[model samples]
Target: MEYFLGVDGGATSTALALCDREGRVLGIGHGGPSNHILAPGGEERARSAVLTALNGALAGAGLESPAFEAAHFGMTGISRDSEPARAFAAVVAPLLTARIVRIESDASVALAGALACRPGVVVIAGTGSVSLGRDPLGREARAGGWGYLFGDEGSGFALGLGGVRAALHAHDGTGPSTVLETEIPRRFGRSLGEIPLLFYEGRVQRPEIAALASAVTAAAAAADPVAVSLVNTGAEGLAAIAAAVVRRLTWPDGTAAVAPVGGVFRAGSVILAPLKAAIAARAPGAVLVPPRFEPAVGALLLAMQAAGVAHSPERLALLAATWELRSRT
Candidate 1:
């Protein structure tokens, strides 16, 4: 009757799932923004989100308090070595009744989630982008996770920026005409001229800008040349990240399993077409895979691994599918 908990404390929201020793998800819970790098009270916010979601999942599982055998916290904004990650570990360890509490970066959990703890590579493109890889011997490596300031080249934010730039160029008659000139204004419900002021004033936030990536994907689908170019370039950037990780690892067989995740990938063929092409060109012999589960379920697998318990990948995959279906409700 051992229970395990997996929490994904994200920048936009937090989700948790409670599962049994067999990886059967018993309950799911969610809460608001929990990215701890936002400062002011980022740690507190993350803690609250984790606690709230934990209680909700516990209640759903018909429990009074957390009495789990192990738990994994996939926290956003703090790497395993960062002070905040350490502080968070201290803050949360005492709160939960679980005998083992492990905290790690969201990217690490994403890789764990995608491969079910098997050695593999994962490229994540949400508000930001990062690629991580693990070898069979447990050696881990990463590339392109520098954030939106200068990196995140393949992220939603980067795609949106390209879209905005192309739209402005088209409006000024400096770039080839594309659907973005009209579509951008429509997506934002504002005049195209306002974008300049918004950018100059720093009012255009990352998420708002990243939202434009969808417009890029949509226009590319419509055969807008400028939009199509951005998608291709973005895909190349993402693929480069994966290739970089692949090069660093020692894969003697040269057949590496790669997975891409996040909203940027939601465009399906819009992004994947170019991404696969570039990965083939750069990281030859890499095999791409769709993720088996979301990060929360990956956290559960990590918890099980920490407790020295062997998990059936087939069972964990099934449990992840079931949890995902329940999450949609």
Candidate 2:
């Protein structure tokens, strides 16, 4: 009857799950933004989000305080090289009744979630972007997770930046722009004339600017050339990241499977299509797997692994199916 708790704390939101020894999910919970790096009082915010979700899950399962055998948390902003990760772990450990509290990079949990702890590569394209791969020898390599400022190429931020660039280019008569010039203004309820003022007034977060990625996707789908080109370029960049990981890792076989996750992938396959093409061009036999579970479930899978629970193919399939169903609800 050993219970395990897993938390996936991301830039935009957080998720918590409780599972048993057999991998049966007992309860689940969710909370607000927990990207420790970006949030003021990030450590406290992360701790509160996780604890609230864990308590909610316990309450859902008809328990006052379920004793957990182990707890694993995957959070953004707490890097492997930094003290923030340790400090956050210490805060969580004392509150948990669990014997162990493990803290890891959110990317690790996302990779684990997609591959079920199996050796493979995962490319995440959310508000930010990163590619991580695990080889058969358990060696892990990562590329392009530098956040919105320096990197995050092929991410939401990238897409939004492209959108703005396209609009500005059109305004300046440097590039052929489309309806976005008008559409962008309509969506934001102001003319391009007002954009500078809004930005100067601190009405926009960097991520909020990147939030335009969704609009770009929709515009591309609706046949906007600028948007389409932006998506295609983004896909190419993501593919390049995946190929680099594949080249660095020593796969038992020449080919490796790559799983794509995050909002960018979930929004539409148009972005992924070019990425898949690029990966195939380089690694002809590489398999691109649709993510079987959200990263939170991957966090749970990692927790289960840490607890020494083995996963069977059938169980993994069941878990994937269950998670997909749960996600839709």
Candidate 3:
């Protein structure tokens, strides 16, 4: 009757999964953003998100007073052993009765879930971009993740902003004509000339701008040269990040799995093709693959590890099966 909990607390949302010793997921819960860095109220906000998700998970699992053997929190902006991590650990300590509690960066759990804790790199390109990798020796390295202001070159925000800039340029007759002029404006229901005001007036934020990436992807799918170029450039930037991680970590076999995770990759081959090609050119040893499990399950695996549970194929298989079933529903 040992229960384990895993929490994936991100910039926009938090998710919790509760499971049994055999790896069958009993419940899943979601809540608002828990990232202490991006939002105000820092620790308080993260604490609320974690509690909401944990309560939901407990309710869904029909467990009112079960003692969890272990719980892991993989949170964004809270690196292992850092000040933010320590603060979060203090904030959640009273809420959980787990014997073992571990906290780490979201990328740590992402790499674990993407490769099932095997040695690999994960390139996350949501609103922002980051590349993290682990070696067989448990050593880790990362590239990018500098946020939208200075970095995140191949992220949704980057692509979306690129589209907006292209639209503006086209309007000013400084750039080649493209459908982005229409496509970008259509997303905000504004004319091309009025789009800058949306950002200047604080009417649009990062997530909204990131959402524009879909329009760019759609335009690329429709064969707009400017949109296609933006997608390719974005792919190249992501490839560079992955390549940087590949270079930082040692691969005895001269090969490593590189999983692309996040919204930007939804463009499918429009982005993947260029990403694969660019990675081949930049880091030949890196291979792009689909993530084996979502980040929440990854956190669960870490929780199991802290509880001294072996990551046996049978246990992993059980977890994977449940993940597949849950994802479908």
Candidate 4:
């Protein structure tokens, strides 16, 4: 039986899936944070995460180490053919014997998963944010994936940082009074003054700060004007990212799917309503859609493609069913 492997390595965790040519998923495994760029230990950290997940998946599949027909690793902070990507690829390459191996940005797999590789845009908002799209003609474009240091506009980190700043501003009388002043301390168990020290001292990291986005959205839900304004601003920023990609790609039918993937979207209509409106205004041709499959399955689809395999409807249905069943446990 010809086997395939697909991995989705993100800022928070890594997930790997093993499947066969017939689209039957044998097993799924998971590991910790592996975003090589942001996560300490860099390529070594990422390599450990991938191997841990791969081993778990293989064990679940009841198989010893075996060569795969094709494998794809969709990783955060990785770009096609980039130096970091190449370095990480080299670290893992020796462990797997595959006819084809691909290392690409997590956004690439998210887009493929969101649209089932059909052609559309995907905006991923986690600790970071980026937008990527592919035209029907196979032309591709991307915008806004500069990472935390540059701009992660609509990302969880941005919203969370806004909350922290709002708290600081309120405390110092520089901004309007908002619940975030109390809310921030309640969440972090620290006064506003200590928040900056959390980062400066390395006691907290990007993901920790990004976690505060939920508090901001919760405040928005409670009708805090300041929080509401931040939400809207963040939504507009994300829409702008999507708008940039939409402009670069031509959809002959004058329409395209723009899927928003990640934790920030969990705010539901609180964030989605503004995001949808902003996207509609910026690119009338774009339609916001939920992803058809998660990124690991997207990576699997890409793996199959790299092996020169056609993904028929029957195969997709099989993959969907099996993945759903496996994920339930």
Candidate 5:
């Protein structure tokens, strides 16, 4: 049986998969950060991530020279117009005799994954936020994802910064008294006064700040009003992104299926419950649905399609079942 490859080059790390013609997963691999804009070493690091992952997958499955018929790479930080995808394709060209190679933004793949390649909307809220959707006619639209400097509302970075700002506000006696005043310090194991020093020395970076999102969620869970409000606002921001994309697409069903994916979604009911309500309010008939698969699996589905492999409903189900089985082991 022929095998295909799929790579999810995410902001934090890279994931690669090998699958059979039947869509059953054969092996999986992982590597370091691949985001071109945010990750260090840019194209070189991206190339290394992909190559190492492919090698790891092959080694894990005890294969010395696995052949790929086609491959797809779904990556972050590169837009549809970015040449990095082409560069990545070039990097892999010599490694395999694949007939087809395709690369796209992580947002596009997330949408494809959320809807199982069906036309629908997906909002990704991890360290960043973006929403993308496809119409039945293959047309697509996007909202947010402008990056942290511009947009990225409802993101972990945003939530973390918000928590920090709220702490400062309370410290200055300008905001409501909340647990964040102490929680922030306790979470970092630093005195509140030392936060500025940490930032000044560049000791606190995006990933470090983004980690504060967990503290915010914990505070909200403990019934802190300010934390609750922040969570609600973030959920609304995420909903707005989904609403904007849904507005641009022509849904075959009166309702568009909306799905949320990413680490931020791990906030659970603290985000999803309100996010569902907010999207429903703005985008009439928008239905929040469970994502069909992870981004890596979505890339696999797209790779199979690129190779002209038939992925009927039954086949997709088989693919999902196969992934479940492999993941458990």
Candidate 6:
């Protein structure tokens, strides 16, 4: 019984899955941030995380030893260019014992997962944002994903930044007052007066600021105008990214399926109404579809493909069913 491994390494977390030749998922594991760009000592940290997850999965399956015939990793920050791919290969080769290992950017896996290797678009709005699509002819296109510095519109960072601006504006009586003024301070365990000291004293990570996005969402749900506008703006920005992908792919006009993923979408989908409206206004027939499979599953599919394995509907169903059963346990 040959086994294959799939790893999805994200900026904030990582997931690994073990599957058999027939596509039955034997075990699954998870770990913390594996994106090298964000985490120092990235290569080693990633290696340790992957190994830990693989071992956990094996233990869950009651297997003392297991050999992976092939493995694939979809990770953020791994370049698509050949030169960078080669560099990454060197960094990762010493870490795993698999017979074959393939690595690609997380966007590729997200796209494949959402569409099942078929042609469609995927918009991911998490701590960051990116829009990706693949044409039926295997052509791929992308927009955004420049990180929080330049782009990442509609992402957690974007929401957090907007929330901060709103809070500050309210403090100065320059903008519409909202509940964020109170909520932001509460999150940091201090009054608004201490926020500057907390930030300048190196007591907080910038990403933690984005953690307030959930509170903003809650406030919006409670009818806070400022929060409502912030969420609406985020939805609009995400929709614009999706629209760009649609235009690049030139998908047919008749409810073209678009899969939305990432934490931002999960937390703020109510805001997506305007995004849907915006897309429809421009593309006329685009429909948003929730992802049927996670990005790790897509990595598994790619691993299977790399190993010359054909994925039938029956096989995929078996894998999904097994995973669902395991999840319940």
Best by lDDT: 4
Winner by TM-score between candidate 6 and candidate 3: 3
Q: Candidate 5 residues 95-117, lDDT tens each?
A: 66677788788887787777889
Candidate 3: residue 85 lDDT (0-100) = 84
Model 2, 7-30: lDDT tens digits are 888777788887777677777888
Write model 6 residue lDDT over 237-319, tens digit each, in one string.
88888878877775544456788887776664566676677777766667887776778888888888898988899878987
Candidate order by lDDT, highest to lowest?
Answer: 4, 3, 1, 5, 2, 6
- TM-score of predicted model 5? 0.92
Candidate 4 structure quality by residue, lDDT tens digits, 1-329 = 89999988888888899899988888899988788653457867887888899888888889898889999989988889998788878878877788889999888888888889999999888788999999999999999988786889989999999999998999999999999999988998887799899899999888989999999999999999999999999999999999899999999999989999888998899999999999999999999998888889999999999998899998899999999988877
Q: Which pairs of residues have clashing backbones in candidate 3?
A: none
lDDT (0-100) at residue 64 of candidate 4?
Answer: 92
Q: Once model 2 is optimally superposed onto the true structure by TM-score, how far is the C-alpha of residue 309 displaced, in angstroms? A: 1.0
TM-score of decoy 4: 0.95
Q: For residues 224-268, could you state the per-residue lDDT of candidate 3 as single tens digits? A: 999999999999999999999999999999998999988788889
Q: Model 1 residue 59 lDDT?
A: 79
Preferred candidate (lDDT higher): 3 or 5: 3
Backbone N/Cα/C clashes per model: 0, 1, 0, 0, 0, 0
Candidate that beats the other on TM-score, 2 or 6, i.e. the better one: 2
User: Against the true structure, what is each candidate's TM-score?
Assistant: 0.92, 0.92, 0.94, 0.95, 0.92, 0.90
What's the TM for model 3?
0.94
- Kindly indicate the candidate among 1 and 2 with the higher lDDT: 1
Query: What lDDT score belongs to each candidate, Candidate 1 first?
Result: 0.85, 0.80, 0.88, 0.90, 0.84, 0.78
- Pairs in clash, predicted candidate 5: none
In the order shown, the candidates' Cα RMSDs to the true structure are 2.1, 2.1, 1.7, 1.6, 2.1, 2.4
